[model samples]
Target: MEFEVVVEGAAGALVAERAGAARVELVAALVDGGLTPSLGTVAAVLGALSATRVFPIVRPRGGDFVYDRYEAAAMEHDVRAFAAAGVHGVVVGALTPEGAVDRPLVRRLVAAAGGLPVTFHRAFDVAADPRAALEDLAGLGVARVLTSGQEAAAIDGAPLIADLVRRSAGRVAVMAGGGVRAEDAADLVAATGVEELHFSGMAAVPGPAVHRNPRVRMGGTAVPPEDERRVNDPVRIAAIMAAGRAGAARRARP
Candidate 1:
């Protein structure tokens, strides 16, 4: 099984590469559930990475997957920028008010990706029908779909993920993500039969602040000041990768 680690910047990308991750999903403001990263950050990550693929998320904002004309246009511009930066792919998805894949708008974004492969992000999890959305993504020639089967965690949604894998029939890759951990990697993959897994092996690291401000907050929500800085822990990432590979090997045994 391949591991796709979610990273925020160049430092995280380097950590992922060193930790044996196969790919990195570059994003910004992960606390907001990941938004489109800046072009400079993308360029830095691309330059720092050696073999690991970079698939930057093209979301203009967090909250909902529903996008308007302006957001769609911005996403297109970002996609083009990523392609020009020599990224491996882009992670993108759009939904309608009824929670269905916005095929027409997604088609336009995919077209903007040029020849790069696209991975429909977890927006599929909120769709009205998983099977229907899988079909639509396949029809769009998406290389993969990152989902947790509409649940808070992939293990909790393993049954639906398994069904999605069976229904996909190799037409599109079903990547199980959301709260993936080293301990549960085997069970999730064994149950879902997924070839890829996505996770953010992140942990809270202390920031370099001599004096702390108790009344200031950079985020919209209230979070502990010390918990604001999260970084990719290579040890955690390596453990997850090792556990996932071991599980895959175990399943392959006769």
Candidate 2:
């Protein structure tokens, strides 16, 4: 019955708050599947969105969920950093070489998080089996699990997500995320019977690079190339918020 918007920056957090989101998942390098944000970025987002809780992501690197000892150490450091900085929660997950949830590692990180909750990130999607992974995460006492239901997108995996919700049965919270758009969020919620939804309310922002660079001309060959970057846009955030609210409303209706 609630939506949590993932904010790539302070701007996105501000928009999420204005649009009445329950919480903000803060991260930097959104292009890299959301690595931990800088201290300044975290502080700015926390300060800016005083009302909305900020859950700083603790992903040390993008790409695969399997992390080496160094990366594991780095993720732990990030977890400690976020806890010290007073984040409401930390979003993180790690897998073993065999693609099973690293229970011991996750337990240590969850303890390092202090009193803040630990949300097992979408790395759960890549697990060998989502149902088994959910049981493992539940046993580890993870507060929540963010997943795409083992499908490419939440909508595609709604049936599985619904099953996950039913299987979890309050032992742990099941949050459906990944490729969740405004229009389809309600359907996802209804199909999956999940109470929490997550999405990056982003839009393409104008590039800072100029169309042409005279200093870089080579052999009288100058060709302009198009570039685009997706960043948090307040307008898009509002729209996503509207969609989530509409979904909640529909679900509440008799």
Candidate 3:
């Protein structure tokens, strides 16, 4: 099996690459569930990675997958920028107000990708119907879909993920993600039957400054400034990759 690690910046990408990750999903402000990374960050990450495929998230903001016209345009612009930066792929998804895949908008983004592969992000988890959404994305020629089967964690949603994988029938790859731990890698692969897995092997690290602010806050009520920043851990990533390999080996046995 292959592992795709979610990274916050170029530093995290480098760490994940060194840890044997096959792919890295670059993003900004992961505390907000990941917004689009800046063009400079994308370029730096691409420059640092040689073997690992870089797929930057194209989300303009957090909160909801429903995007306005302006937001959609911004996402398209970012997609074009990343493609120009020589990224391997892009993670993108947009939903209608009614929680359906926004196919028209997604088509625009995919076109702006300039022939690079696109992975429909977790917006699939919130789609009104996951099976229908998967078919729609396949029709759009999406290379893969990253989802946790609409549950809080991939293991918890393994049944749905397995069903989706069986239903896809190789039309589109289904990548299980969300709260994927190193210890559970084998079980998740066995249960979901996914050839690829996505996860944030993140651990909290203290900020650079020695002193800390007591009252100031950079994020909203959900994520506070003093919550300690999270970065990708190489040890955890390697462990997950090893476990996933073991699982894949098991599945390949006759």
Candidate 4:
């Protein structure tokens, strides 16, 4: 019944830890669905949190899951670096042109990770055949698979997620993620029999009013304002954690 928070920077990590997150999946450019965070950001988060484990995402870029040779090599290097930096684990994913798990690249990344566990990211949800992809990942000894059962929101994919959980049979951990809401935490857990849940738990807050060039945006119109930050909220995170634990308990009751 552990909660994993998806966070971008040190501030978000601290918020997650305060809300009882067992661990966090650290990344950058979360608006791009999370890119690799700099080592400096990782260090800052590691220095800030005492109890919560930091597992930084090793993604090279945010586009498609299918990566080129250079991108794959960079991912391996990042995994090894994160391992040396004392991260608990690394989150990563790769797919072939045919939309299947890239076993060769993933195997290399896992080897570079040394003793650290590796989590296959949501790219599993986009696989041509999720069931077969899961089998491939499990065979490669991937520690876990984060997916929404090929749906945009985990709640919508509960049935497929539950089926995956039953099929896993403890061979690999099946983590439910993707638009996971606090209100649905207990029901999602109870319905899917998933022990791990992942979500951003973020809220947009106005930042310091020290900006002069408001007209010049760092990103496009869709991106948050330059002075606004999207950060994890402690209240939402705690509620989800409490509800998830309760759900686990209820299911355990014979």
TM-score of model 4 relative to the true fold?
Answer: 0.97
Query: What TM-score would every model get versus the actual structure?
Result: 0.96, 0.89, 0.96, 0.97
The deviation in Å at residue 211 for candidate 2 is: 8.1
Q: Which stretches of candidate 3 lie over 4 Å from their true place?
A: 224-227
lDDT of 1 by residue, 145-248 (tens): 99998899999999999999999999999999999998898888877889999999899987888788766776535554653589999988988888788778
For candidate 3, lDDT tens digit of each residue in 9-115?
A: 88899898888788999999888788899998988888888899999999988899999889998999999989988999999999999988999999998899988
Please give the CA lDDT of all the candidate structures. 0.90, 0.83, 0.90, 0.90
lDDT (10s digit) by residue, model 2, range 1-254: 66788887887888888877888888876766788888788888888877889999888877898888898898888889878987899999998877899988898899899868899999998898788899999998899999888888889988888899999999999998999887788778777778888888787766677775546643233222234456666666677667666776777788
**Which residue pairs collide, candidate 2?**
none
Residue 151: error of model 3 in Å? Answer: 0.4
Clashes of each: 0, 0, 0, 0
TM-score of 1: 0.96
Per-residue lDDT tens digits for candidate 4, residues 1-254, read 88899998888998998888888999999999889999989989999999999999988887789998999888988988888988999999999989999999999998998968889999998899999998999999899999998999998899999999999998989999998887888888999999999998888888878755778888879788788888898878888888888878888889
Candidate 3 clashing pairs? none
